[model samples]
Target: MEIRQHEWLSASPHEGFEQMRLKSRPKEPSPSLTRVGANFYSSVKQQDYSASVWLRRKDKLEHSQQKCIVIFALVCCFAILVALIFSAVDIMGEDEDGLSEKNCQNKCRIALVENIPEGLNYSENAPFHLSLFQGWMNLLNMAKKSVDIVSSHWDLNHSHPSACQMKELGVIFYNCSCLVLDLQRIFALYSSLKFKNRVPLTWSKRLYGVYDNEKKLQLQLNETKSQAFVSNSPKLFCPKNRSFDIDAIY
Candidate 1:
């Protein structure tokens, strides 16, 4: 017809060239969608290698529990420094045996007596044949009964003539019996020698007759009443104003 109708409008089958040949068609996959995309890319590479081996085994179990708490704090500071070096070597071995037993008890309590000579020489002013006035005239020639004489300074011209010759030699050689003489320290040495004019008037009437003989020997020992007199008669005499013959009181 007109050249066969212009070749049927130039092969009128051109629908935008068959959609540009199925948009440059190269797609050919379909073996059941290529086996579901190769099993979803091998299960996402085995879940990224099991999350990097579970974060390297949780960082090697927290570095082995911080090396067992720093080896139990260095074994408790080496057992408290070996118990303070054995308690400072047992307190320096008991202070060296208590300083060698206090230096042998201070060299056995050292002593030595005879080296006296230092001053007032003449062998220290002589006088010493067992003298404290010859041991008080050998305890007033070993008196048997009584001879008390409490003195304060009864130096009536040198200890009242050796205390009236030791009370008349303890009543004629130890037949003593009694001779008390306290007189209140000789009336305080006659009131300090009557205030130092050195009293006289017969020494103030012999210190008022020794204060009236110590008030009549304390009223004859409160009115004598005697008894107890066991005696192996070395002249068993008890009657001298007996009560309990208070040998010496004033």
Candidate 2:
């Protein structure tokens, strides 16, 4: 009898469980579970794929642009470095041509003038002429000072009386009637004076002449004059190989 009772109790529980399962089957899945499944399916299909691709492309473009910018900056820096080096070399060469403190004595160039104007001829003159002359003078004077001497012969009657002071200041004049005179005669007078003073004189043949081999020689001669003056005149602090002479008043 006890065995039958145990079997009936187990059977009753099995039947009740079957009935509960049948009732639960008609209910739909939980709302939360259904939403989770839908989200997973949408992610797999990539419904917002267009927006995602756009964002990805934008990011890639930004990175590439940053790299290009870095490269351009490097190139600019390199160009600047090269330019600085070239400029330094040019400056060194120019400075080398100049006389040092040790050689600043006993060297000078001299210019002899014939019919110089009354006042100092320091004006550069018309535009272009003045610019070139002034530039050359600046280069020369930086190396030395005090031109040797300017001399000419003037017959006071024909000469501009204003030029008289020039003669007094070592600018000797012999046969000049007035400052208004021939250019060649003036140069000749200057050359003659240089010869007499025992001072080496150089000419800038192209003061207003053709720019050919002759012009280059004149410029070279000008440099030579500077050198001679520096070497010879020890009283002044100038190099032995720097002297310049100018026929122009400036």
Candidate 3:
């Protein structure tokens, strides 16, 4: 029956059978697109998860870095504050080391040099204020040699009568700029040497260290005193006044 049907279709041109045959040949079904879509979705989900995890890690690291930076800034600020405080303290200490008010005024010795001539018949050319000019004139008469003076304050620019008088006295004046003005020390030194009777004891200033000339004189004096030590008796003997019994008596 199949051969007869084929022979008949060949003889008669059966278009319906041909069409039916073409229709019967099954069309290839599109490979399950859903499965591929699911796979693609899963891959996309994994990539999203990885990206999210990386973003979270990066955010955490950035936050930690921010915190660290804040802490570092605070530490640097604290260090700067400490350094400024120490620097201020150092400056204050340096300033304080110079002198004090109590020592400055107390150490000064105001010596009355000489009495001025009262009523010396002052003319327009010679105005003699006894109290002021007398001491200065005396100082001028006294300073015939080099005068080394040390004091807390000195105004060399001011041309006072005393300053002029000192210049006239043939004195090479060297004023010391120290914290305290100890005129008493110089006076005492002159007194010890008995030069007080001759020279005017009004020192214009005060000093700090022992100068070369003074140090040399002190050394020479020390040497002289050391030489005298040979003539003096040695202090090796014990006191005879400390009585002790011969035996075990207390």
Candidate 4:
């Protein structure tokens, strides 16, 4: 009965049963060799190929690589060899006491260079300040090369004030901008406010300690009220006071 029903489905296009059909496998499951085309491990070699030719091939490939590397190195060496030869020839040919040659040929020997700023020491013993000047003079006396100079502002002398007559010189000197001007203004204000007479004489020589060991001088100040004495050097003389102005020529 079952064979008869199945036979009818084969005769017809659709199977006789609803939503059901027999699936036909052409062959049953079985193990087979995978055919990835032969490599040494996978397939047997013919006798003509011989036992282990791969190692010899690998060695040949490495030898070719090493030969290529050597060729490349020789090419690099050749590339720089001409430049090295030229440099060596030039160095050997050069009569280098080049500095001495330059000095002699140019006839200008700038012997020493010092970065001495203006008014180096001119304080208590103002003569010490001109040591740079003295050294320069001595150098000039012995080996007189017209001195090299790099001055931005004009009149680079300070033994006397700057020699330029301009009112507003750049950066360094300005006639309106004087250090003494501030001091003058301050003194003027102090005098106008009558601070000198008005400030009480509270200070005396009562402070006592041995400040000077050699002279046996005592550090006595602001102790006694009546014995204080101030210096009387700067007496302001009328319009003549303008001589202190940095702009004053003479």
Candidate 5:
């Protein structure tokens, strides 16, 4: 009798199939889940997110503390490097000012090895630039013992010029003036001046009479008369060495 009652209690397929199927199907979701924040939600909420989460923020300038610490570390390293450099310089010389004093008191390397570039900008502040041939000649003349060449390239003869092939460069005047004027501009008379004078100091004027072009260095005391006898000084471009002098004249 008990076994028959247990079989009826259990929903055996033969006993009550339709009634058991209806019980298994859900009528609706639980009220606690569908009500919203208690358990389940269809979409995310702003309040549910943590403060640490972020989107774009790639520039990172907002983190002032990290940037300040990095900058402070760099400044400390630079200060340390500067200190080491000064210490090394101090070790090189016995006294603090010894290195600087030696540099000021001496003139080294009378010989020159020049490397002037081709197609150089004409409107430079330089007095003038020599052609490649003139610079080579000058180097030969100045260097008796040894020549020290400092050059980015060795194509002086091929690239820029040998003797300034371009007539418009005014480079011939630049070279020839230096050669001739260095001779004409120098004299023993200038040695007695209280302030020492150097080469490229003065421009000279030569005057000759029309008696078959007789050559002489004549002295005329009158300033007014002297002006008429001498040719008007050549264009300032030919002789101007100092930028301030060129600027003032122009």
Candidate 6:
């Protein structure tokens, strides 16, 4: 009896208890060195990747700003270049116009007439009237196309009556245009009966009359009236009875 009981007690065949003992034991399995190293490396790689991304973004921003600044500078330079070019062209055009006018003046021919009679003051000496008349006749003969005469006291000269003949000759023979800037008083006399008494047969057929309108004539007459007594000068005259058919050429 003793021998049989002691065999089971000394070596109990319980595999479950051994398994439970192994499972319940304090297991202090430290993490693998390789695994920890891999984790640390991954974290560093993630940090490096994030830093590189930030640097790339910053570089892109800087590059865009530089491009904008360069573009602006180029535009400004182009504008300045265009302005300078236009200015140069305008200056060259003005210079060309001025040179053309100077050349025209230089090409003009001049005539020199000698043997001018001495002591021939037409204003004071009545004996020089023939010379003055001859000189004016010569000038009128020289005109081929047109003549312009400006006179303040045309009626005072006795030789001015010959001017009508010259004007008729210029208009009929040479088909020339003649313009006379006669004073208002002298013009009135020429248009009135005084002209017929002075020259009965020498009035020009192609003669044209031009004058200011009636309103302007009235105002000028008023001004003349106000100043006539103070100066005692020639009285102004407006063509009251003349025709208004011609165009206003004043």
Candidate 6: lDDT of 116?
A: 27
- For candidate 4, write residues 1-250 as lDDT tens digits: 8888788767665643432444543554443332334453454655435556876788899999999999999999987887565533434321222222122221111223233444443367533222334445664675534433333356446442332222221221112112222223334433443545543222111111111112221212223222111111122321212222222222
Model 2: residue 227 alpha-carbon error in angstroms? 9.3
Off by over 4 Å in 2: 1-21, 24-40, 43-52, 91-161, 167-250
Q: Tell me each candidate's TM-score.
A: 0.29, 0.31, 0.31, 0.20, 0.22, 0.29
Cand. 4 TM to true fold: 0.20
Clash count for candidate 4 is 5
Distance (Å) between predicted and true CA of 110, model 3?
A: 4.1
Instruction: Flag clash pairs in model 3.
Output: 150-205, 150-206, 150-207, 151-205, 151-206
Error of 4 at 70 (Å): 1.8
Candidate 1: tens digits of C-alpha lDDT, residues 51-107: 888877887778877888888888998888886565333343222123221231211
Which of candidates 2 and 4 is the stronger one according to lDDT? 2
| CA error at residue 28 for candidate 1, angstroms | 6.1
Instruction: Identify the superior model by TM-score, candidate 1 or candidate 2.
Output: 2
Candidate models: Cα lDDT each: 0.40, 0.41, 0.42, 0.35, 0.38, 0.42
Pitting candidate 1 against candidate 5, the one with the higher TM-score is: 1
RMSD of each: 29.8, 17.7, 21.5, 27.8, 22.0, 21.6
> What is the clash tally of candidate 5?
0
Off by over 4 Å in 1: 13-16, 28-35, 38-46, 49-55, 87-250
**Candidate 6 lDDT over residue span 152-241, tens digit each:** 465645454444334221111121111121122234344453445343332221121222333221111212321100011122222332
Better of 5 and 6 by TM-score: 6
Residue 145, model 1, lDDT? 64
